[model samples]
Target chain A: MKVNKYITIYKDMVRQIESGQRKAEDVLPSENDLCDQYGTSRETVRKALNMLAQNGYIQKIKGKGSVILDREKMRFPVSGLISFKELSETLGKETRTTVHRLGLILPPSEAAKELGTEADEKVWEVVRSRRIDGEHIILDKDYFVKKHVPLLTKAICEDSIYEYLEGELGLSISYAQKEIVVEPAGEEDRKYLDLGGFSHMAVVKNRVFLEDTSLFQYTESRHRLDKFRFVDFARREK
Target chain B: MKVNKYITIYKDMVRQIESGQRKAEDVLPSENDLCDQYGTSRETVRKALNMLAQNGYIQKIKGKGSVILDREKMRFPVSGLISFKELSETLGKETRTTVHRLGLILPPSEAAKELGTEADEKVWEVVRSRRIDGEHIILDKDYFVKKHVPLLTKAICEDSIYEYLEGELGLSISYAQKEIVVEPAGEEDRKYLDLGGFSHMAVVKNRVFLEDTSLFQYTESRHRLDKFRFVDFARREK
Candidate 1:
């Protein structure tokens, strides 16, 4: 599939920003200059800049042009379907994924419904907790369809199952519908995470789909209340 | 400014969905059919459909084409910067807004910093609570730059300041950076909302910008933990 021109520009600028080629707080080239350089119209350049702004790559200051943001302050964006391993690598932090359970089991009814599987269908259930800098902050319960991911191992879960799914299996994770809510810590959450006396948890319920729009995974990530923070950049409709 | 062709198609389709011209659970026209009807390429048609999916207007099901989701089940989308009035109208519920406070005052340093206003500068501070089904579930604290909204009244606040800003003031709200966190409930939340002994609240901190990229408003929406739900549709980058 061919990418849109504005998206190409957006990705190029994001790469430059993340690579530190475009310094934080430094204003990018004006729309006119970017249009001239990219051989695109000014509107297209603006579109690219808007995408950057919406994704927290840059902030369009009033008098100043699009200026890069302090990327260090922004952690892994919860808006995307990214693995903890990839997020830790992006942040250059020492992170460890401890797989508590990994096996094929009959999924619960809710999980089956979300994954579009039958009641008796076998699915891989992986329970893992992500420790960042020696603090267990997130506990993830993931269920994947057996048809989509036939093989599962604790080692792969400890490392990155997403890497195996995308690299070895060549499966593309396309999109997801995520619901976030705050709930009282359950027994499972208390057992998995070091609660630090927090009574609530930020629960993210995710229904992940593949590129062909097949429901493949259902995950719930519960984070300690005080440690949970979600940041999003959104544009208002015209 | 000229709107993109695909965006126009996307908007039209969204209107159709919201207005019930296309019922929920109904599959939309096939890609080829849409391309033929709109005189556009398949890629452009797909682009429009992707926008619809991202905005929760439709869900692309595997082998079933695009299907309209039950909009009522999906509450206010966390992906867009929308006003309560607009959201309530979309839900078609008898939602009422009660203004608790409306005045111009010196904002706190944090609010001033977020809105990019001087500490000495007067800003409009509005406190309101949303009542849905006879229960107060949300309390909103909004601070706007006085220069942007020179005049304000409790009546307008009771109705919709966003409407007045966009319709009468001709100010186009472009985008916002929002942070969601769970915090212990405060005295203000206890007094304003019927939190029902819940110890925590889901707080949404928003910094809104105008079309010209000027920070104009800072708002904090506090919701009872049990009543809070945030939904978002996201696509992975290839």
Candidate 2:
């Protein structure tokens, strides 16, 4: 429901940057050009440009307009257990949430291990579909040990479960362990994703912990192959 | 070139596990069942089953046939500095590496920030296409600051760059800093990935560091939207 015109314009600018149409170090077509192209006011263009600068997408200098920023050495930590809402906010993009399935379910063994609970334990299975840039691309089936999060419903599922957890129940997200995979889209996945044809799925598995490093949730995020990725920064020994 | 046959069968088993057709805790359709279904030998089927058991995909009791593992509590990590080769290997899937583009080039500004090098520094830009389960899903474009890696070529790009870095050149990969983003695909990406009308790309940015935590390489892996993902585990605080 929260939409911003500037963010949309900034996104289009990024497309230009990533595609190589706007080379790194290439000064942008002035805020005036952006305003003209986006058909928005100068203030709106500045807001969008500001978001880009904060996220390291581009840089602006006084009296010189902005220069497209290079993305060479930038990295964000995946070790932090972040909710989609948290991540989307960090990325400065308009994120929309959809609840496909949310209910109490018995923990399957694999899901059980990730949750640090016994097989057959009751867990809150919250299946969330995330939309970024008006595309519903990620299907997240998150499992919370019933002890931590109790009394959930289909309506709560439609909203940010993390918000309900932190804002309503007063819980926090801390540390996490994660695994990544690239696989083919299957029948169950196809039903939800609605891909015209068979597509690959990027499967990410993780164990989420609280600030004190207490394990709280187990999440399996299925990304439409083209939309899921993980980046990192490492130091080299001399 | 080292592909595991047990894994090929395991993938099919995983497919069944995911589909409602195969319920958890229920014993698998027997190694013999698998052999008939997959048209392979009993040994091959057992090996596949063993892999499943090893990765927590299934459980095997000595006298009884293997039990289908429950997957609801699965832990998929979204955060970590993990390698594609390692991920595919862990899943026991056959991952083929394809070189789309590779060469040395000057570090772009954003890339320089990630490489922790000078903006004008030279680096090797290596682009590799990743195929798992016969699907070309990810295109990884890696930028290496010259001091860490002195040589580059299309042939080197064909094999695992990390393999060569660790084995031939001794650039041990200690850890990496990472970030993930969901965005639309650009023209440069379309050339490397056969994205057929797919609209988005998952951009994973990584800066590789050594055991000493010194930054040496920067890689931006672009996952086609349909095939991108991140998973993880977590716990809540009281």
Candidate 3:
């Protein structure tokens, strides 16, 4: 498959930033210089720079060129359907997942509504807590339509259910609709997470659909307020 | 100006949903049926349907077509650079903005860092509270680089600064990078907003840029937890 030239440039720049070759507040080369260096047009270099800016890698200054942004907090992309395992891998930090509970039970009212399950339909409920550097910061509650998922185990929940669902079960995971809201920490959150002095948590509600567009899973990820940060790049709508 | 057929279809569907012509859980016409009704190809119809699904208007099921989604909470788009005035107008809600404070002063340490201001640089600080149906739900703290803005008034602050900046100042608002996090409600938040019993708030920190790619403004919008909702549609990146 042929990749776009601008994407290649974007990836190389990201590598440089991530590898510490490009430090924060460092201004990038001029567009003309980049164009000549990459043997690409000015438009192409700008495209790459735009992508960098959009992803929070750089800030474009009017006359000073693009400056690298300080990336202290882990950036959770607001527009990606990434799994916790994938996210942990990308962070390259010491992470562990603890499966608190795994069971096949009648769907809760809210989960039933979200999954569109009929009466007497069962769903797989999985609860897990994520620990990074000995700090428990995230509590995930997941429900899967038993009719679609069929079977789930604690071991699978400990790993990545998405990997099993897609690789083993041959399910074509497609798109998702996500809603983020701040809510008071519930009793379950207190039990599964290290709340410390925080009284509220950021809740990310996600409904995942298969390629055929069937809603198969509903997940609520609760994160400790201080540990949660979502970054988004937005273009002005004309 | 020529609008894409799919966008026209998408807008029409949004109007139908908003006007109550289409009810929640109501199944939309099948792709082939929509193609025939709109005199378009299946691909075009699918694009329109996709947009509808993406915007939380509908959910597509494997064999049952698309079903309208419940829109009880106001859906806040996560990837748009819209002003509060524009959002309230779209919501058609009784909203009021109270300018609690507006002044030009030396930039605050955090604001200075975010705006990339040098020493001795001044910024216009505007603090406003948003009332929806007589309940104070949002508090906005905005800092604008005085060099670019030049002037600001209480009237402009109470109204829409973006409007004044664009319409009067002829500034081209371009893009923004946003960070959403939950934080403990500060003293200012407790004083300005109707917190009820909640002790935390959702903070949306935005750094806005102009068409020239210069960062000119930094805004921190604090919202009551119950009143905050952000919706995003994301596709899986392969």
Candidate 4:
């Protein structure tokens, strides 16, 4: 498949922004200037700028061009189903993953229903916590259907399960449905995360599917309230 | 511009889901059945179904076909910028909107910076709360630029401000940037919303813009922790 020219431009500009070469609050060059510099049409330049705005890299001011937003404080794209290893590498942060439990078991009825599993079917359960800068801010509890992921181990859970699934197993993740809400911290959250006396936590529940339209995984990620933030760029539907 | 044939199918199905005509857990007709019913091709029906899946209206299980999710329990779509009046009507509930405060005033410096307002300029501040079945569940604080909306009235505030803006003023709302976080409920939240002794609230901060690509409004919507839920459909980036 041939990639669009505008996507190439978008990736190049985003790479500059993420690598600290383009500092926050720095104003991007005018569209005319960018088109001239990149040797692309004005429409292509606008497409790249729109992608930048949609991904939360910059804010477009009316007359001032696109100004880089301060993504330094909390720069995680919760919109996509990205693994912790991929995310930490993107941010260039020292992150550690610890697997508390890894085994096959009968999933909860709710999880089973969401994962489209039968009554007797078993699924792989993985409980892990992610530590970024020495704080266990995220606790992830995941259940994968045995049909999709037949094998699981503690070592893979501690490393990257997504890598094993996508790279080694050659499975393609298509899309996911996610729900975000705030709830009182459960016992498991307190046990795994450093809550800092916070009684509430932000919970993201996800139902992941494969390219062939099969439900593969059900996950619940609990984040300490003070450490949780979700940013989204949305266009009004026509 | 011509709209795609599949989009027409998508909108019709979405209307059915929103109106409660299509009940939750109801499995939609098979692609072949839908194609025969709508006089369209299988590809067109699949496209409509895919749109439904992307917008959180349905979930497609591999063997079970597409099953409508229970959207009645929590139906407000915080994923996109939607007015309360438009949302409540879709839910078909006896919703009431009360204006707590409405006037022109000097916005806070932070809000001014986000809205790109002059230091000496004034903005319209409207504070309102939403009640569903006599339970106040939401509180909204909005600041609009005076230049964009030159007229404001208490009647319009109590009614639908979005309607007045789009219909009467012919203003076009294009997009918004939103951030969601959980914060300890303040006195205002406790007083305005029936929080039921919950200490935490979900705060959605929004910056809205018009079709001309100019920032026009800054809003903060506070919801009772138990009453808040955000659903989103996300596609993975390859």
Candidate 5:
């Protein structure tokens, strides 16, 4: 494969960042400066920087210069299914769960429809705040069909409820239907996640299924916009 | 099927929106008001509202109440396989393409690598402004392998260059590798697309392959964040 000069420039910048020569808040060289340094046009320089930004190696703040990212991102598979505990474990990151609220609540009409149950159905409501690398990255609100996982509490919420269900209760999860969108962080999210007022969230609505293909749980994964990444592979001829 | 009251409330609200009983920008009742009106808890009330927000029925602004959406959504396929004309046609929305710049230019090193060509290779660079519903929503910069499309021009860029390539030039497109991310609107985009600073752009970068499995085109589709929607299939046990 022919080596691209811009890729060389991109790698060099990555090395600078990884080696701590360029600190997190240090401003990357301007496009014109990079063009002069790399002996390439402004377009080529911008293209290299764009790749860096997309890979989360840098954050390009408009008007301001690009800054090295504080941390490398772990690819969070939003498309495929992975329990929160498993994902955190896979990444080998310091993962902590804080249960803010949990209760037996009456489901609203809309949630009832999604859960394939009746309105006013009693459900286990759990609110969890996930902190990764010491930063609160996700706020999750899960509603479980009471029949599947009954008698939830704040202490149980702090633990992996999915683990308790499948391990202790022997309940099996089958599948889920998820809807993903970009939405702004709301007041409730701001209180827990400390998200900037301008920050948008990657909202995921999932209707979880049981082993028998029954709707058992519904979860909403509100991801910090900058932290969420989804990737997939396809054949060149597929 | 057992009936769920929350779902009943959800359907009722959806009907009100769909039937035009509730106009766009109108605020629904607050959570406290809804709890009393529906005789449900705050969580139950929010359940219905979250559904409304996810399905594009309303916008939740922090501090401000939820505003009903106009529902004039222009859907873009996440497949990333369609040409500009095909995409516009699929959306069934009025879209005009303005050929801002088109010329035979030397490909940058990165473009050459993606195209499987050499650095400084002769390539056709076409810059076009895409207008959806009379508003410029995207500014695209497309690079085509000159070896593939030998005689591309500005006139070709004006109206579905992909159509001209397939119909007249007779080069069949087969597959593509696409990457998408949120990016701040650039100078050219803000100037031409008339987008304000409040929103970002969904930037899609694709590597197009021909019928022979040869990479031939590189396209960047930048869409306004608020207007962008992505839908895909995922299969995994919850």
Candidate 6:
């Protein structure tokens, strides 16, 4: 596959920043210098820099060039339907998933409504706590329609349910609608997550659908207030 | 102007939902019936229904039809660089903006770092509180580089700074990077907003750039925790 020159430049710069070669507040070389170095046009360098700025890697100053941004906090992209296992693997951090509960139960009213299932329908409920660096930072409560996800186990819940659904069951996960709000810590959250005495937590509710437009899963992911950060890049519509 | 059939259908359905003709939990007509009503193909009707689902208007069930969703809470699109003025106008509700403070001051250290400006450089500081439905729900603190803005007035801050910047200053607003985090309510928030005794608030920090990729503005929008909700539509990357 032919790669775009600008994307190559962007990836190389990301590598430099991630490897600590480009420290925060350090301004990158001038566009002219980068153009000469990469044998590309000024427009190409600007494209790469724009990507960097959009992804929160750098800040573009009017006259001072692009300065690296501090990326110590984990950046959760708001526009991707990514799984927890996938995200942890990308971070390469010491993470552990503890399955607090895994069972088939009658769907809760809210979950049943969101999943478009009847109240009497059984749903696979999985409650897991995510511990990163020995701190429980996230508590995820997931409900999957039993008609679609017929089989689930504690082992799969501890590992990756998305992997089981997609890789093993061959379910085609297509799109999702997500809502994020700040809510007071619930009893379940307080019991599972090490909230560090915070009174509120960030709740991300997701209604996931399949390729056929069938609602299959409803997830409520509760995160410690201070441990949660969502980053998004938005372009102004003309 | 010519419009696509699917878009026309989508708009018509949106109007129906907005007018309360379709109540929450009401099952929409089946695809075949919608196709006949709109005199369009199944694909076009499906396109319209998909649009409705993606925008949180409805949820599609596997064997059943689409069901309307309750949209009582304001849905803030997480992927748009829209101003609060525009959003309020769209909501068409009783909204008021109060200018708390508007003046030029030395940029704070954090604002200076985000805007890539020196601490000595003066920046236009605008603090405004937003009241919707007779409740003070949001407090916004904005800093604009004086070199780019040149002039800012309390009236502009009270109305809409983006309108003034684009309409009068002739500066093109291009893109923004946003970070959403939950933080404890600060003194300013308590003083300016009716936080309803909530200890935490959702803070959205935006770094806005111009067409030339120059970071010109930094804004911190603080929202009452219970009054904040963000909705997004995401597709899986195969």
Ranking, DockQ, top scorer first = 1, 3, 4, 6, 2, 5
Output candidate 1 Cα RMSD.
3.7
Per-candidate interface DockQ score: 0.56, 0.20, 0.49, 0.46, 0.10, 0.41
TM-score of candidate 2 relative to the true fold: 0.47
Cα lDDT, model 4, residue A160: 92
Task: Report the Cα lDDT for residue A107, model 4.
Answer: 53
Deviation in Å, model 1, residue A51 alpha carbon? 3.9
Clashing pairs in 3: none
lDDT of 2 at A54: 42
* Better candidate number, 2 or 3, judged by lDDT: 3
Q: After superposing candidate 1, which stretches have Cα over 4 Å from the reference? A: A1-8, A19-50, A53-74, A109-113, B1-8, B18-36, B39-47, B56-73, B109-113
Q: What would the TM-score be for candidate 3 when compared with the true structure?
A: 0.78
Docking class of 5: incorrect
Q: What's model 5's lDDT at A151?
A: 70
Question: Over the stretch B1-238, how does candidate 3's per-residue lDDT look in tens digits?
Answer: 8889998889889999989999987889899998998899997888789767755678788877898876654366644688999888877789999999888888556555678787788998889999999999999999999989999999899889999999999998877778898788899899998999888888889988776667899999999989988877666754
lDDT of 5 by residue, B1-238 (tens): 7867678778889899878899877888887898898898887777688666544566556666777765433245454367778777767888888988778877564444556577666888887888888778777888888888899767778878878987898887755556666666677677778675546677777777664545688878777766666653233432
What TM-score would chain B of candidate 6 score versus the native chain B? Answer: 0.69
- Highest TM-score: give the candidate number: 1
Worst 10 residues of 2 chain B by lDDT: B229-238
Candidate 2 vs candidate 6: the TM-score winner is 6
- TM values, all candidates: 0.86, 0.47, 0.78, 0.79, 0.58, 0.74
Query: Which portions of model 5 show Cα errors greater than 4 Å?
Result: A1-76, A89-92, A109-116, A147-176, A209-214, A234-238, B1-76, B109-117, B154-175, B209-214
Categorize the docking of model 2. incorrect
**Residue pairs in steric clash, candidate 4?**
none
lDDT of each: 0.82, 0.68, 0.83, 0.82, 0.70, 0.83
lDDT (tens digit, per residue) of candidate 6 on B207-226: 88786667799999999989
Error of 4 at A208 (Å): 0.7
